[model samples]
Each structure stands twice: as C-alpha cells, then as structure tokens.
Target: MKPIELMRAEAVNLTEDPDEVCGYWRGHLVWVKQEDADGLWYVRVNHPDGGYLYDGFWRAHRDCTAADAVAEAFRGAELLEDE
Candidate 1:
C-alpha cells in the first residue's frame, strides 16, 4: 500500500512519549509517522513547527517545500519496506 499524503494542518505536540505522539499523527491517516525522539516528531508531510507542548491542535496545511515534501514522502515509503 502507498503512504497517504496529508496537508499539515498544524504542528502537533508529541510531548514526552514518542510512541504516543507518533500514534496521534498516524491516527490522522493522512501522513505517516517516521522518527519520534528528543521531543521532536517527524511527519511524512510538511507543515509548520506548530511549537511543542501547545494545547489544542493548531490548524495548518501541508504547504511544504517540494524538496521537503519529497524527502518526507520518501522516508515514509521506506518505512513501509521495513514493515
């Protein structure tokens, strides 16, 4: 199956738990969660930093630079290979 493309609606707060944080992003079903560590959550889609530990889901869109979006997409695709 191909990875889904989602416009980043806003930066998501992963908090301390990378697993739970990534789970939230994956739950969106738009973008695939890649690496979550050091309080940083990387998504397969492009959006804003949206700051960390902010309350509520900030609203943004997937307006990522072509290069970034491509890179993230590639990473997401690679993850599928491992699975």
Candidate 2:
C-alpha cells in the first residue's frame, strides 16, 4: 500500500476526493481523512471558528465504521451558525 501522505495527495486528484471532504464533526462541517494511516486512522476535526484539532492520530480506527461514528456524533451535535 502507498503511504498515507501519498494516498491523500492522490485523493486530491480524484473527482471525488475523499481526503478533501467535509463531514460532521462537533456540529461543524469538518475536513477529515477517512482512511487509515500506518495501520491507524484519525479524527482530525476542523472547528468552524477558524481553529482545528488533530492529536497525533491517537483516535485510531481499524475500519471506516469508527470514522463514520465520528461523523454521526458530529451530526448529532447542535448545528453551528458558521458551519
């Protein structure tokens, strides 16, 4: 498999770039990488207030379901005006 970094770059070139996608994360449409990197995935949430959070890819995931859960949780959060 290709490195996650390279994979992300390739995704950007695709018509529907999954890496460059925005999903629900804490009441906001956040940009996230919905795939594993180095045997793990992340929950890098983008805050609508111009700030963001990404903690060492600690929120590891062995499948997309986990990542989708994050999105679900975010969707459940109260929608923000800015988002």
Candidate 3:
C-alpha cells in the first residue's frame, strides 16, 4: 500500500481521556492513547460502521507525542485498512 497524508481532528477525543486524540484516516477512525502499564502508545482504527479495523501497539516510547503515535498506527495498519 502507498503512503497517504493523515488528517486529524484537532479537537476530537473519542476515548474518555482528553489528552488522547481521535480522527479518521482513509475512512478509518484512528485513535491514539498511552498504555498505563508499559507507558507505550497504542492505536485503534475502526471502520466507518464502528467495526474494528486495526488495533496494535506502536513501538513508540513513553515520550512519543500523540501525533507520532497516530502516524505510526496509520503506517502500520495500511494493509488492514484496505479490507
């Protein structure tokens, strides 16, 4: 799959955490949040219908910004987005 630019909803946070961010990328709803135990970042991409599109833990360190985490998720889940 080819890479595409990501567009984020700056004021959106699908989860309860206000610090986390959520937006749609390539028709999938992408959300980035930090892990409580490991302090790593993880992302969840849901389809337009709210079905699970992709869910994975990014290799980002605790200091990684939300934008970077979301970008990693988008890049890692490119192939899954096609289905």
Best by TM-score: 3
TM-scores for every predicted model: 0.20, 0.34, 0.58
lDDT of 2 at 75: 41
**lDDT (C-alpha) at residue 40 in model 1:** 31
For candidate 3, the lDDT comes to 0.60
Positional deviation of 26 in candidate 2, in angstroms? 9.3
Tens-place lDDT digits, model 1, residues 12-83: 443223122221343332233323232232443332343322222222234433334323443544433446
Q: Tell me the whole-model lDDT of each prediction, alpha carbons only.
A: 0.32, 0.39, 0.60
What residue pairs clash in candidate 2, if any at all? none
Q: Candidate 1 — worst ten consecutive residues by lDDT sum?
A: 51-60
lDDT of 2: 0.39
TM-score of 3: 0.58
Per-structure clash totals for the candidates: 3, 0, 0
